[model samples]
Target: MAGYTVIDFETTGLSPRYGDRIVEIGVVKVSHEGEVYDAWSTLVNPQRDVGASRIHGITAKDVLTAPTFDDVAPALLDAVAGRIVAAHNASFDMRFLAAELERVGYVVGERTPPSVCTMRWSGAFLPGSSRRLRDCCASAGIEIVGEHSALADAFATAQLLASYLDRCGGRPMWGDEISAARAFRWPAPRPAAHTLTYKVRADRQPERADGWLDRIVARMPRSADSRVDSYLAVLEMAMLDGYLSLHEQDQLVEAAQSSVLSRPQVLALHAEYLHAMAAVALEDGILTADERSELDRAAACLGLAQHDVDDALAGAAGDDGADGLVISGISLTVGDRVTFTGEMRMERSVWEARARAVGLQPAGLARSTKLLVAADPDSLSGKASKARSYGVPIVDEAAFAKLMDRLEASAD
Candidate 1:
């Protein structure tokens, strides 16, 4: 095998699905002889907040004048075009890069280069020892500096790769077996028929719904990693559509509980989905006594408390407020768009529904949005800087909740 590119990216947040973007990238090219042949690093404007700046020490000000991802994408593509892209957590970097590249009209075709995850390999090979790059490097006597900086992390990863190669036997000649093991094959795009889609009914009735279950099942990726998510999506869609007969919904929940994989994590997520759906069903007055007992049993299987179930049920019931909000003593109806930020212990769905119930539109303070609900209205990130620049109104969640309380009390 001909060498590989050790890559790392400092992203705005953990998940790419939640609109997070990458702010910086680093790569160190290692030759077949296990020597660093070239190095590259760039700070790209993520166009958003650097949430974990305290840990990485790279801030919005540091990247203020930096080039956008588009500006440096071509060069980045050229550098790693034919090389294996290796990283500590390769999927994290790869998924974000792939999404961004796809957004900019870049075709990462079926022949796209392969990516190797050092973390996965290390865990398999170096069993019973810490696999973190810093710890691995220290144990292997490799020098690394500037821990969180992109280039520094890349360099550290490269050193670890080199050490692994040395321990295996310095500069072993590559053979067909090794070559095949290191071969790069692009992932085939899953067929459209297997893709999952989220569908909502015009009437928003959960019990009389047709096609909702099928639509949710279709939306789930046929991959093993997403099967649990697919089941959960089905349950949520059933609730949202309000078309499932109480018996049919109960059977569907039973199917999910019975058919889930043996993996505890997958089962746990399914349990949560079942619990949430049950709560929604109960609040909607669609569940029978027996079905409610079954759901309670499911929650017990997952080690969830009755109080937790009650809280979730309350949130679902209050989702579309029964009363209008009082804005300076003025009553405003529900379904209005609003936005929220800052510290919130409530589930995001619950928070979002509360915002909508107050006759306010929940939205992020980007140029595209018209409103902002700052949970911590005075916090620098919530309402100041870019959010303030967009001229969106910021209100604390507490204030919004207070208005909602007053409205409900008046109605009562």
Candidate 2:
């Protein structure tokens, strides 16, 4: 009848399958006698844009020096190794945890402990309507300290679990549920630790990349975070000669390890640099053999998959210059707000440049943009989801081009 480990996670979004990731974790272990054994929490630097910041209130600045998921994976594994993991929405947090563990090469189901979803049992305990965390806590009269913070949520969930057990007056059906959760087997466990401390950089300037990539990363206002800076520094070196040298590889690995970037973050960054390359590869016309060769090495250094590389190249097919077929009828004026999602035919830089050329304005993903140009209107990406939720109009690449062309013509 030992108490279970109640857990909670603050993630970038709801689904891990859509490349959403966990940004924070909190856990509270309650003893069988209803006494609290331990509590732990940490902010995970996802090494990318912490999406839906408005909802979670976790600003990028908060995770500036936070450890990456892999760095904290061992500790998380240690915490949940033998305990039963419980959460308000256990499946949601469990899915994210499982995805992260598998990403790091763990065999989730076999090595993982069981889990409990407090949400399912809400009907048995909480009175009235909603199964939402806040509602359930309210029904039980349990106080929720911080609405979305992982630590606060986990602690509250732990309190709720105690209430559930107290209601049953006996050891609840914990064993079967544990086994059922184990059926979702997560990946392997690494090391275990109670906490991790990060050292602030003594050098204010930090290390800078002197290559052409400096301009690129510099212009990207979003890549200003510490881990991203390090990631870009390695890419800067790699792009200098189109091949990451042995020395550069060492630096890259060191930076990556130091950043504690989760496996997905690393993959995302790799996609980023490749996207940067693709955005401009065909700007001067066709990709020369030398350019193509350099890109191949860059892809290897970035650890990008062949399919990703091919996808980058596929965008080049749309670069047919003035001879390209122009899908017309769309119109736009100067100062119109525009944004983009999906893998577009044009790179972000080129898209922005084109927008400026026509006296139009380009917007960031989450900005109050009027239009969202998407490669596929049906994408499940966070941007597309948000756009759909906000009732933003989504246009295809052809429509986007036609709009831009119309604007250009009007200006002339």
Candidate 3:
């Protein structure tokens, strides 16, 4: 054989049988001598909520613009073609690979190519070492920097595989498997006119010559009355993290351009958004220090100066005598139902308890749900998705905490 194709997948959860899907995949090609030929990775949109993002660091927002498994199937097939597949836990990786390929209409028959499981053979190489990839890497004196990330784990596994090859006196350790791999035939997939690939925001070098908001505004043509709802929704999601990634910038630009929003109109929307946050902050008749800090961060993310925040706060405070302002479509009442999604730093039960203490009803996601609290405001969890479709405002934990404070004040 020539070399092995090492692969890894960061998935929504264990078992495609449970509707879990691959959110990201990493492939590393190494020569028989353990020389790395190429390493590639991409975020794969699962088309459903990304489950257990805490493990993989893949939020729903990260894959918002990513290519689906169907779109990237062609490229992935090409990568593993004619090569022995290797993974830390070969069965898990192989299972997901086969399942995903099958889902894309590839006739991945009952038989798959011979594969190497670095973890499976760890007992022989690093006697007494655990099967965990991190543990095996530690025993081999190899460091995995970004654990759980597909590419980082794949590269580390490649290094471990190289060590095994070196220890085995430069001969093929699995002669039978290699032979089987050589005889194995890969199923032909439908040829795609163009295949797509997308990296997570963290993987791509940011285009930071100017602020993301400015870049988005630049793409827009002047229009008298540009549609605001679509652009506003995109803006709210992008600001969830208080920092816009390159992909998010693209989303914003696309939203604005498609809506025919002009530079002035977009700027106005930004001002309105900040003002809305400010108004919400002061809804309880007081702007807590934390709320002010939150507004400041929002202002920075929107590419607005501190003066703009001051103006927004002043404007919002001036409106205190009028009907209370709602921020991003969120208006919380004492009995309004709220739902939460994604893994949060605080326990879900604790959040629910706090909600009850504040006279808010914590309930399952439904059309009647008034608010959605998410670890990532742009979470793609089923609850978050349903909440968005219902026009419920999603807020991060910090924002939720601030809201609780306001609720208590209002109740008093």
Higher-scoring candidate on TM-score, 2 or 3:
3
> What value does the lDDT take at residue 158 in candidate 3?
97
Off by over 4 Å in 2: 109-113, 179-188, 192-195, 198-412
* Most lDDT-accurate candidate: 3
Task: List the candidate numbers ranked by TM-score, top first.
Answer: 3, 2, 1
Model 3 C-alpha lDDT per residue in residues 1-412, reported as the tens digit of each score: 5679999998876556556689999999988888876998898999999865645777889998999998888878777778888987676677678888888888878864468878656645775454467777988999987877888889999999999888877785566568777887777656876746567547532222334333222222211111344455346435534566655566566567654666665666677667766665666788777667766877776778889999988987876421221133334778899998889899999999989988889988888887788886544477865675575667678767766877888878
Candidate 3 deviant stretches above 4 angstroms: 201-412
Model 3 misses residue 28 by how many Å?
0.4
Question: What's the CA RMSD for each of the models?
Answer: 24.7, 18.2, 17.3
Query: Pairing residues by index, what is the TM-score of model 1?
Result: 0.45
Each model's TM-score? 0.45, 0.46, 0.49
lDDT of each: 0.54, 0.63, 0.70
lDDT of 1: 0.54
Mind giving the per-residue lDDT tens digits that candidate 1 earns over 1-412? 4567888887775545556688778889876567886887877778788655644567777677777676667667665656667777565577677777776666765332346655534532343333356655665677777766787889888877776666557643223224543654433332233322211112211132234323222222111122233344334433433334454345344435433434454444544444344444554466567555654554554446666556545654655421111112122345444566776767667877755655556665566454455545434563444555564444455546655676556556
Give the TM-score (vs. native) of candidate 2. 0.46
lDDT of 2 by residue, 1-412 (tens): 2447888888776556557688878879976555665888887888887865644567688787888887888778767665677887565577678788777677765333457767656645664424457667877889987666788888888988888888867566455575555454334565544457632212122122344433333322122122343344434534544556565565555556544565665666676566556556666667777667666767887777667777767754554321111121123677778887777777878998888887767887654676788786545577866775565656667767766765677778
